[model samples]
Target: MSSEQRVLHTPDPAERENLATFLSRALRLDQAAVVRLRKRGSSLVSAWVATGFETLAVRTITAELGVDDVTVGADTVLAGLRTGHPVDLGYSMDSAWRGALPPMDGFAHVDDVPARALVELAERGADLAREHGGVHGPPASLLDQSVLTVTGADDLEVQVPMRVVFALTAMDFIPHAGEKAEARRIQPTELVRVRATRTWLRLDARYGSVARRLGGGIPLSPS
Candidate 1:
């Protein structure tokens, strides 16, 4: 993953017109509407399809020199193009679809191994929380001057220290015993806010410890 952000360049009139025609047909629009095309990096293109009224639909289309490729991402981007309603293009669905994270700052790619590992860890965490009657803390946290080293297959590693916010919930109970009282009463819970500078993610290699516990066989050997 490169630290430098990808740039988007405005498409020329011919390019825009071609994309508009394609989008109009794909989206089943009655009128041939004008569309906006922005060059993403070197190969990917982002198209803003007009709804012909007030709003516009934005999607990332896989193209090389304004020529659309017959790929899953390109087809998905075309199919996803709509009118009137808003769609949230949260993260890139695959490598071919390079949807920009809005306000666009930087780019990072997560391969299958890491993605599966993360998912497995999450499931294990949830299971532990449910069985132990406790809540799991946030998986990732932002640190002012701290970095998290993520190691992947082939000894690939990166230090990501970006700012992020996460929420966590916890439950606690007070134990009380009285000769006159047969049952304990539940008390109202209060919220407490605290500030911290650092966070940690623990990992182990045991088959039923974390990742393997989820039955995904994601080899996440965190140290």
Candidate 2:
């Protein structure tokens, strides 16, 4: 068997700003307009956002804006785009992300911005967006009132009620350094739920999108 090891890279202040620039160009938003983000419980929750506007543009923008570390796949996407290749902006996000991983604080300083970073950021953003699916299509909205059921083999089912008001879909789930191994999925319509005691009558997962896109934009099914 031919197996390879994956090594992770740490994101520095320069790279973080570069990523922000790439994201701004990729999403066609001003860098000043974009907000720096931190991952909420392994994934970037929508509540962490300043606005209720939920789109892959928002999600991926936040994902790349992360300062702690960058995913190899994301780097590859950026590199490919820089070289002018087809890329897919499509990725997946998961609930219960911090269920197993260690706690990590926010990226670097909040207000830090590097000079001459937009050029590299734009280049990387174009490279990464080449084959990304969400770049062309409408972005995924945040889940309003979704039910995540835990149905194991032998017809054992446990439904968890959840309410997700602010959250990203796929893009945010990519650079979650922790829980990568245990983060497995099964059924398209199935997902793990995160309910808010502060808010009532809310669901964060979707069966319709899963049915339409299959594994593409479907919810996460736990292992």
| Candidate 2 residue lDDT tens string, 1-223 | 0112121122344443444334434333222222222334343321111122222222222222223321222333344344332223222222312111111322111121111121223233334444442744322321222234434345444332111112222212212224321223222233423222211111223210001111223223321
Off by over 4 Å in 2: 1-33, 36-145, 149-167, 175-197, 200-223
Per-residue error for 205 in candidate 1, Å, reads: 23
RMSD of 1: 20.2
lDDT of 2 at 125: 36
User: How many residue pairs clash (N, CA or C atoms closer than 3 angstroms) in each of the candidate models, in the order given?
Assistant: 0, 21
lDDT of 1 at 180: 19
Q: Which TM-score value belongs to model 1?
A: 0.22
Where model 1 places Cα greater than 4 Å from the true spot, the runs are 1-38, 41-43, 46-60, 63-80, 83-114, 125-156, 159-223
lDDT of all predictions: 0.29, 0.26
Residues 101-175 of candidate 1 have per-residue lDDT tens digits of 222222222122222223333344445435654243323222121223555445544433211100010001111
